[model samples]
Each structure stands twice: as C-alpha cells, then as structure tokens.
Target: MKAYIAIKYHINLENKELIEEISNALEVNKIKSCCIIRDKEEWGRKTFSVEELMSISFKEIEISDFIVVDLSEKGVGLGIEAGYAYAKGIPIITIAKEGKDISNTLKGISKKIYTYEESSDLVNYFKRLKETSIIHNSI
Candidate 1:
C-alpha cells in the first residue's frame, strides 16, 4: 500500500540525518511516500496561514492510503497530521523517541506506534512491519 510520511519538516533536516534514514526506509519498502515539505522552497517560510495549512494537509492525507509518521520531535503540525490520518480512517505507523509524552490528541486514536532508539532500529522497524503485514494478509 502507498504510505505518506508525515514528519516535522519546517526545520532544516540536512543535519539531522534521520529524515534521510526514513526516506531510505520508505523507498526500500517500495512504498510511495511524500515528505511534509513536498512543495516548500528552501530558505524561507511558505507564507501559509493555519487554516490553509490544515486544509492542504487534510487533503493530502485523504489521498494517501496510510500514514507513516515520525514524531521524534514534537510539533503542532505533526500532531495535526496524526490526528488527520486517524480521523480519516487511515492506518498509522508512528515513530517517536522513548519516554516522550504523546500528546493527548494523538493518544485518543489507537495507532500501532513504535519507538526507535537508533537509526538502524528505525530501518528494522520498517522491514518488520512490512513483513508482518504480508504475513497477516496471507492468513
């Protein structure tokens, strides 16, 4: 199934390397994924108001089949995307650091959340999830 990768994209990810790791995971899974900054230009704000952002975000989530989200860093936008996916009846795979408080808004929805302590673990998680899904469906 196609998956949309939702992450905190407003920040410069060049230094983080986590985004690249996640991108590779998505591609290796042969899953179609789009980053949150899909249309944004570098080095400046995109000039969108809150309502407009939500509208576009909701639209994208509706078009996508499932959400694979990175909540390694907390952000209001990521929370919104998580909520949007849940409300739209899309399956969710969320990754967050261990011990971080999942916002109440996100917890309200039952998601198959995972935690990754390292980048390698993140890749492993993707591989395992995909394999498990294949097995589950063949039953």
Candidate 2:
C-alpha cells in the first residue's frame, strides 16, 4: 500500500518530527509513503511552478491507496490536496495535535481523525489498524 502525506510546506521542528514519526510507522507496516517536500529533496529539484507541483501531487494522489493529512496548521494547499484526494475516491486519514482547531470541511471528508497529544499515539494507532487488517482491507 502507498500513502500520500499531505502537510504544510513550512513547518516547525515539532511538525517535522511528527512527519518523520508517521513515515516510520508506515514503514513498519510495510506501507510506502510519499510527500512533496521529501520527493523534491530526493529528486534534487530546486524549484517548480505551482502548476507543476500540483500536477505532480495530483498524480501521486491518484496512484496512492490512501492519504494521510496533518491538519494541525491550516494551509490552502493542504485543503486542496485533501479535496482532490476525496474527489478521487481515496481514503483520507486526518491527524492533528490535541487542541488544534480543524475545519469542518476537512472533517467531513476524513475517514478517520486522530487528535493526539503525542506522535507515538499515531504510531500505536497505525499498528492497531495494521493488526486488525483495517489498513489492508478498509483502506
């Protein structure tokens, strides 16, 4: 399975670590994950036009089994990605830090939402989901 991780382009250290943790958790479950920022770095690409980026992202979302979106911080691009994934009939797993306010529009499209105090909460949840075969069958 493959997951497209949608997150704010400009993130703090905490959010960065959270993305890393999420990636690690997905790896343990044998799920391949991708995101724009990481892909750009891996490709050694310095710049891309907005249209180019969106084209790439849309292609990635189209091929992914599901999407994992971090909504702790609001961003137009995040919403766009979630909306595109939803339109493509792809499952969305939304996550946010405890106490962060998420827009109703996002919640409406999410298959599951996790409000976590620690990143480990997400890791454990993914483990449980994999154990129950939810990730494989449902997603």
Best by lDDT: 2
TM-score of every candidate: 0.76, 0.88
What lDDT score is found at residue 130 in candidate 2?
Answer: 71
Report the lDDT of model 2 for residue 88: 87
lDDT of 2 by residue, 42-81 (tens): 4334567789989999999999999999887888999999
> Cα RMSD (Å) per model?
3.5, 2.3
lDDT agreement with native, every candidate: 0.68, 0.83
Deviating ranges (above 4 Å) for candidate 1:
14-16, 38-52, 134-139
lDDT per residue, candidate 1, 95-132, as tens digits? 77777666665656635677777766766777787787
Off by over 4 Å in 2: 11-14, 43-45, 137-139
Q: Give the TM-score comparing model 1 with the true structure, all chains together.
A: 0.76
Spell out the clash pairs found in candidate 1: none
What's the residue-level lDDT of 109 in candidate 2? Answer: 93
